[model samples]
Target: MTFAFPRAVLEQHTAFLGKTGSGKTSTAKLAVEQILAANPAARVCVLDPIKSDWWGMTSSADGQRPGLPFYILGGPRGHVALHDSAGKAIGELVATGDLPLSIIDMADFNAGGLQKFFNDFAPALMKRMRGVVYLVIEEAHEFAPKERAGIGAENLAIHNAKKLATAGRSKGIRLMVVTQRTQALHNAVLGSCDTMIAHRLTAPADQDPVKKWLKSNVDKMTFERVSSSLASLKTGSGWLCSGEAQVADLVQFPKISTFDNSATPTDGDAELHVQTAPVDRDRLRAIIGDAVKLAEENDVPRLRAEIIRLNAELASSGASQTVAAPQEEIDAAYQEGLWTGCIPSWTCSRT
Candidate 1:
């Protein structure tokens, strides 16, 4: 049965973590596409670091009723190129900076070359956001590892994302961080999400994080065994956890029908071949431009700066920034901090 998302928490942000060939990317793409198709005003931004199979749609930016878009970054020849709807080359953006600091708030931490993209590109795109802005990230551990517990850009990003997950719902920003190793993700990232999608991860160690993240709501052994059993689930079959076990169930995607029937060769009737059109470059550029424009109008830079400063401050407190606190308490602390800024000397410390 299909599950419905709560309107109050309508901005759906999901984390699909699974090993290679587990179909996390394909599943995310399907869900986002469905969201866009259902809502004409909807838009999405994807941070594709590896330029995986999803790159095929990069050239079709100009077509489709609500055209889909794509942008290609790392590939052979060591240069980043932006393609348009017609598969035509447009221009290239510099690929430089520390990788860790690229996407999150680094505060001069280990932010490799990716810093250039996040600081230069991401801010611009987030501004023009319209209906919904979903962030689809794979290999998330590279940015947010479990072992290192300190202040960094990756940590900052996680912090800000969690904040957004809790409060950005009304602001129209949604995030979906996909990874094969669930344990590697920060608790803040997982905690912010209302829904968690698990694929065929067979290890108990990997599933341990979810157990801790979900608390007594889910048992470690049961989740591990359930996820491990996914090998038998038809290609697209998987489960959705929304805090209630009675609602979650295995689901399968319908076979994709293409315009050119001849293009699809006859195969085993059981295995449906779903064709995801190549990434659309022109559309991507347009979406990025639109998102950037929205962010600009809504003071995205200022908001990000606020988040950056708050993150840095929290990092200095000598406590885990991902520490789970009640919403009321968090708001109280924020209020106290604001009041402290107004009142010259009295600072309230966490009790």
Candidate 2:
């Protein structure tokens, strides 16, 4: 089962909400793998607050090409361990200031001398790569709660996460927030996300916020239907709601058996199944028409690229944006007669 999200919105960020054992981590892992497969240049950082699901899902380094580098951010002696990146000691990550103290204290992970390490090491690591960085945070609510959070040290992880959400886009950083308590999550995180994978949510408060988030007139009945679907969803099925697309989808992941001895799930496995209404033809045509119009106008790669990007977004979510193409660009296209250029080429010419 292949599940493709709108790349445009997906580039910004994403959030996954579900109960434990609801396959949130598995879904997240599959998403990461998919992104990596698309772009091998993708760099990722996984912060497992409890150090389980995300940590163990990496390939080992062989005598040949090195495997992906995996690091554990919080734990005793709390130093970073190099799995695929050999020749690197665990002391370096511990010696760096990148580790948040708040995450340290909350997890009860004793880093010993590494306490001073992160304060001095974080800035350096922040400067390393310029490629796409996927930051995965599991049990996110503990780090960024709206109320009764721990003082300074325990809040560092949450604070850093928010900071990343606000500015990471420009820096080529993408965040994937996975949590069971969607009701307690911070809006800053959700607001920053372009795609949201909603699993089983039983909270009314949590259910209400999404309606407001999408600014959609989703009635109470639709909300309940969406929520109820999540509760009974199979391992790889859930609802995908985004600024650009909202669909009941089943994401089929790859099978894990194809890979080496790695614990990561193999490719060719279905991630989830989405059960929802059929595609609305009229709406899809309108969206396609708008995209064609944009392509005809301007004729610039950047501008046309943006239109295609938006079209994909709308296609995934089944939602349209209120922001339309600027009037000046449209007028210029018409004046230059560029508007008709793409139309004839696109028509089927069928009998």
Candidate 3:
């Protein structure tokens, strides 16, 4: 059965909890797609540690909507460094309305890098938000673990995330946290959510938190029935519970309208084909101009240093010794829908 959420309800904090292979990502994607479809001005930021799971949001195949902007902070295709400046640049990009939907692939970063990026990005994003923004965190437990110890960076990240969960709503930053292991997530973050879309979960560790949270809203008999139903749910089927029973239901998601780029890769599917389209020159120019402007306005020393280093490298290589023709040429080429030189902090591919 299909379930639709109003804009008001969509803006509230939500959680997607289930075991692996239980369709948490797919359901979350569908919810995001619908949110964007219903509100053209809405913005979404996905923290995808898997790097490839959210590509469908940027895929423009037969049934998919036009692709969204893509940013790779630390992944196989990453171009942006994991420095604080780069993190802030991304936050500024989002805060300044430069990106509509941004998927940050974090698969390549080490634990330390991941923690630093998250700690830096959340505050920057909250600082300049002018409109409502949805922040989707996949593998939520990694960012906000239940147990704290010698992991300083992770603990810092968790602290920042908890702050966002508790206080970000006034700033128009909402969260959609996806996790396979509910027991491992920080209680503060989980407790902040008023809506939960839960799929099959048999582990007592996982079930207990859900039951504990629902007990206050659902009667004992209904809770038992819902608990049993949750344990036996098939893939793509789950219970959608809001703060109370009157607004909840069992939902069965239909086939997603976009390409499943996140599908598990098998031996036979090793060499898949992806469609590409011509880049939009005006959009590319606007993005570049905004990024440069934000970098200057934010006084990001690392970005400035990186730019200087790149210019020096170009000069020393004699490719643009006279007047740094490499960057100039790159800009000219991009204006003509061609990409040259190394990847920038953010890159857009048409498909």
- TM-score per candidate, in order? 0.53, 0.54, 0.75
Candidate 1's TM-score reads: 0.53
Clashing pairs in 3: none
Q: Which lDDT tens digits does candidate 1 get at residues 1-351? A: 554433322356677755565666666666655665567445454555443433323222222222243333333211133211111111112111111101121122113433234433443333433444556655666545665545335544554445544665555667777777787777767676666666665567767765554444456665665555654544545566555332344556442211222222335431133332454445444533543333233332343355456656777997545433334433543642322231212232444
lDDT of 3 by residue, 1-351 (tens): 356664555778888999998999988888887887787678888888654577655555442344544443334433232332356667777777776667777665444556767887888888877788889999998889898655548878888889889998888888999999899999999899878888999898998888987786566776887788878899998888787335567778775656566563633342134432234545644564544343233333443455567767777788653233244444544543334344443222322
Q: How well does candidate 2 score on lDDT at residue 236?
A: 54
**lDDT per residue (tens digit) for residues 1-351 in model 2:** 345565764576888877766667767777766666677555666655444454333332221232333333333312222111110122222223222111121143223222222222233334442555666767777656656444434455455556667776776667788888877777788778777777665566766555455445244665566656655766556666665554434454343211132232424232112111133334333423442243334444344566667766876887653335555765665654445443221222221
Q: Candidate 3: what lDDT?
A: 0.70
Angstrom error at residue 28, model 1: 0.4
- For residue 112, model 1's alpha carbon misses the true position, in angstroms, by 1.2
lDDT of 1 at 276: 28
Q: Which candidate number has the best TM-score?
A: 3
Which structure among the candidates has the greatest lDDT?
Answer: 3
Better of 2 and 3 by TM-score: 3
Q: After TM-score superposition, what is the CA distance of residue 78 in candidate 3 from its true location, in Å?
A: 5.5
Q: Is candidate 2 or candidate 3 better by lDDT?
A: 3
